[model samples]
Target: MTTSLTIAQAAEATGLSVHTLRYYERIGLLDPVERRDNRHRRYTQEDLNWIDFLKKLKATGLPVRAMLHYAELRREGNTLESVIERKAMLQAHTLCVQHTLAELQENLAVLQRKLVLYDELEQAARAAGARAPRNSAPTPPTPERMAP
Candidate 1:
């Protein structure tokens, strides 16, 4: 027999807060979890595996709406149309992730260039006899600079 996990155990296994797990169910990201006769939720290995994939999607920057749509399609049962749609969505998401990685790489290069500029600015200011600000790093990287 397959051993079932308690909600607490699921949370620990998935590195998700208990509240987040409940929220996932509420948002339809997860199908309604099975419950024991006394009303405690019992999760199976399948559930754990699904949650792991969800985490990967999230980490890769898939939005909630897209994930929700994927879940809805998955719950529609095993039909050829549904499988095709799921494949299409996953392919689209893969392209989106690739774009994001490219953007992140470009943004990082801009940040590095800006840092070098700041260092030069600091040195120039010091050469002219004024102390430059000690910590002038930008808050975060963004692809705002126009690429040449």
Candidate 2:
């Protein structure tokens, strides 16, 4: 027998609110969920797996419209053309994520360089028996002045 969870259990397990799960269903991101005799939704393991994949896509900054498009493509069944289209979508999204990651890394390097400069300034002040201003921080070097 396949293990199934109620909507509440599915929400808890997926770390999504019950309302969000219902919204996903209503928005066509999720297929209409199976229902029990009492009309409560019963989420299968397959449902949980799909939800997990959706969360991953969201975390990677895939826009909701894109995610919905992917979901629509997925529902078309696994024909060769559908597979090719899905692969193309994922490839394009991967490039977008890579670009964002590169930008973030560049920004992080700037912050690290600024921290190093602050540390050097503090040491210089201490060596010269000077006290840093109580309420003001030293202006950080401009990007042009910062060491490459």
Candidate 3:
């Protein structure tokens, strides 16, 4: 028999707050949850799996509207058209994520180069027998100055 968890248990297992889970259902990001006779939600393992997938999408910075659209498509069942659309959406999102990662790497390289420059400057000053004051470190470059 499939095990079921209460709403509180589902929230703890998914690392999402109960309020967020309710909000997700209300906003149509999630399908209506099953309920016990007392009207309390009873989440199945399938629901937990879906929630995990949702979390993955959220981690990828997929906007809520896009996620909602994906959920709608998903609920339409695995028809060929829905499958194609989902694949297309994921491909576009993947490209966007790749671009963002590239930009972050470039920014990280700049910061690393700046640190190296500071180290070289400090070493040269020490070699010249001058004690650079703690407050003598150069100010961080502004965006205008950061341009190559």
Candidate 4:
């Protein structure tokens, strides 16, 4: 098996654009790539695997600086200490993601309630007719306004 891939081949295999690969290296998200005898960049399968993890981190909203820090930890050593450090970082991020998900679910419930109320209001308005003057316009439904 060919253990080394040129930059273009790496890009193709990884589904990352060549420019993105270069940018990741420049931004410290990736370790420096090795160069061929002709000075072209070559990536090993290990590099490809690491890029895959970087893609996961980026997709999951890990900030660049934090990701860079994680990269630094990896470069320094792959000891038990580094494993704990990486797990801690991921554990923190997972908690944050969980909180975000909970908030989103609560918001979705509010939206659903508002939609039902809106449908009811629309039906009442049609029954009352457009020409029916109101004493005052309906109050805006902020989250606070939706109180019983």
Candidate 5:
């Protein structure tokens, strides 16, 4: 069995498209690719690992350039402080995303409550020999007319 994989095979393994792989290389997101016969791109196990790291960075919502910076630092060789700094950046971003998610959840709960209230109102309207569609717009508050 061959140790290296073709571009298409690498893309499938990495969950990225062949075009994305090419773009990654072109944009310096990936290190220079090793080619066989100067034509076919072949990926080694290291490349696969790099792709995996890139995927994790993407999942964490890091921008491509931010990931590229991390990749560049990583390629420079392992350093304790650099790793710490990168981890800090990711952690901060994760905290921010979690906060946003919590806010959205709260908003959703409020909207659900409003929806339930609307449903009750609709039922009451039906019982009173009045008819209106569910989710009908609420009346807008009007300003009192100014005395002449």
Candidate 6:
């Protein structure tokens, strides 16, 4: 027989706070957890895996409601249409996040270059025993040219 985990054990295994576990149960994110006769929640290995998967889903930035909907579909068992729809939604979200990350990375590179230039200018002025004058600034890198 597979060993069952108590709520506390599940929480520890899943790295989720006990309150969050309860809250997940309260919401539709999780199915009704099985309970012992005395009213203690008993989690199976499948439950643990599901919680881990849920954490990954939450980490991916899916809204709670959307996640709940996905969970509901999953609970209804594997359906071709539901699977395809879920995959499409996840793929779209992944692409959006990837694009956002690329943009942010480009911006960061531009800023880093500007900082480096400023550092060089400051060092030069300090060596010359004077502050850098605020006249004719260097050409700034364009957003388009910041790839890498």
- Per-candidate clash tally: 0, 0, 0, 0, 0, 0
Candidates by lDDT, descending order: 2, 3, 1, 4, 6, 5
Each prediction's TM-score versus the true structure? 0.74, 0.87, 0.84, 0.69, 0.68, 0.75
Which ten-residue region of model 4 has the weakest summed lDDT?
Answer: 130-139
Clashes of 1: 0
Ranking by TM-score: 2, 3, 6, 1, 4, 5
> All candidates' lDDT scores?
0.93, 0.95, 0.94, 0.90, 0.85, 0.86
- Which pairs clash in the backbone of model 1? none
Scored by TM-score, the top model is: 2
Kindly list the per-residue Cα lDDT of model 6 for residues 1-148, writing each as its tens digit.
8899999999999999889988998997888899999999998999888899888778867778888988888877768988887788789878877887899899999989999998999899899999546885767779787678
TM-score of 1: 0.74
- Listed per candidate, the RMSD to the true structure in angstroms reads 5.3, 5.9, 5.0, 7.4, 9.2, 7.9
Report the C-alpha lDDT of model 2 over 1-148, residue by residue, as the tens digit: 9899999999999999999999999999999999989999999999999999999999999999999999999999998988999999999989999999999999999989999998999899899999867977768679788868
lDDT of 3 by residue, 1-148 (tens): 8799998999999999999999999999889999989999999999999999999899989999999999999999999999999999999999999998999999999989999998899899989998867887778789999899
lDDT-best of 3 and 5: 3
Give candidate 6 misplaced runs (Cα > 4 Å): 130-148
Number of residue pairs clashing in candidate 4, backbone atoms closer than 3 angstroms, sequence gap of 3 or more or interchain: 0
lDDT of 3 at 55: 97
The lDDT leader among the candidates is 2
The CA lDDT at 144 in model 4 is 83
Q: Which stretches of candidate 1 lie over 4 Å from their true place?
A: 117-148
Q: Model 3, 120: alpha-carbon shift in Å?
A: 1.4
Please give, for residues 1-148, the per-residue lDDT of candidate 1 as tens digits: 8899999999999999999999999999999999999999999999999999999999998899999999999999769988999999899989999999999999999989998999899799889999646797556645576445
> How many residue pairs clash in model 6?
0
